[model samples]
Target: MPRILLIDDDAQLGEPLAAYFARFGLELHQATRPSEGLARLREGGFDAVILDVMLPEQDGFAVCRAIRAEGDVPVLMLTARGEVMDRVVGLELGADDYLPKPFEPRELVARITTVLRRRRAVPADARLRFDGLVIDPVTRSVERQGEAVELTGTEFELLLVLAREPGRVFGRDDILNQLRGHEAELYTRAVDIVVSRLRRKLEPLAAIKTLRNAGYALALRPQAHG
Candidate 1:
């Protein structure tokens, strides 16, 4: 069973939600406060996190940043229904996905499944090597110039899509489709935010190239192997 941590201030949301999640073979844990949630995460063993934008102690964005700083645990943010900025800001802070409040329980389960799938996606080859970068699909790890580059689940998936086919320009829709494995009501700018973060992590190498009016491509040439 995949363990998930939910950090929401709603005292009533956790028990029922956890019960519903159990139907899908997911073990859902709850924390009514951000501090409790962060502490549980530090002890590890969670596959993903469900975070609500409105919380006591601090907002969800701050928790997302703290989560990203520590590790690449997959994060699904719960936002105010129809609030675009909430979703955008969560993504920018390295959230793997977002669901609007007042959501159907099944839809939330589906979102969690999608993110977990993306995080555990395995490529055909063992490792992808570029001029100054290396990606090991099995380990879901990346190295830039032989230095380990920690990445969020979404970031790693985006880079995998581009790195798998070097120099192929992927449109925003194309990248989104490949990454999400389904059509979503997300903005194309989401891709740009992820790309920006990825570019920063892969600095000095210019591993990803952007084409105006198009999408992004891997700029690094494959490292020759003997």
Candidate 2:
């Protein structure tokens, strides 16, 4: 069973959703306040999180950052129907997916499954495929649209990091530690520079998306065969 945590002020939504979720073997836990929600999350053991954009205490973005700082848990943000900025900010802040309000409960379940499906505990092989983009970690190679995309060692590692978990956002410091095993420098723009260079090589295929004030994530996958 997947244990899903809901951080929202609407206590009314819990019982019904919990009952509805139970049919699929999902256990639902609700926390109305961000502080309490964070505490519960810190206690651990949640398959995914459903966070509301509007909260009593800290907003969902802050909560999302805190969650991402701890680990790569799949987060699906609930936002207003037209809050374009909120959705962008949420994604930038490491939200695995987002659900605008006025949605059917079944749609929420579908979104949760979609995000989780992209995340596998172990790759079936060293080759990772997202749509038409293929990354072979063993060979340290990347291919797009039947052509090769050459990347620097750092760039390849960075791409590999983001591609490992398609929708998970990675902060600059996290990338630094993974790539160079050190802290990020205040004056350094190395990560940005590398990303820019990489973007050039990976043209026509929008594989990476930048999350401003946060980091980056892999957005595009290889297209499926007809």
Give the per-residue lDDT digits (tens) of candidate 2, residues 1-226: 8889999999899899989888877899999999998899889888889999999878999999888777667788899997877876775665656778977898788777655544433344567788768887766678887788755444666788888778899887787666543432221255666676677678887878998898988897643322
> Candidate 1's error at 11, in angstroms?
1.4
Please provide TM-scores, in order, for all candidate models, with all chains considered together: 0.96, 0.59
lDDT of each: 0.91, 0.76
Per-residue alpha-carbon lDDT of model 1 for 1-226, expressed as tens digits? 9999999989899899999999999999999999999999999999999999999999999999999999889999999998999988999899998889899999899989999887776767768888889998889989899899888889999998998889999999999888876657647989999999999989988888999999999999987532
Cα error, candidate 1, residue 23 (Å): 0.9
* Model 1 vs. true fold: TM: 0.96
User: Which 10-residue window in model 2 sums to the lowest lDDT?
Assistant: 180-189
What would the TM-score be for candidate 2 when compared with the true structure?
A: 0.59
Model 2 stretches astray by more than 4 angstroms? 127-226
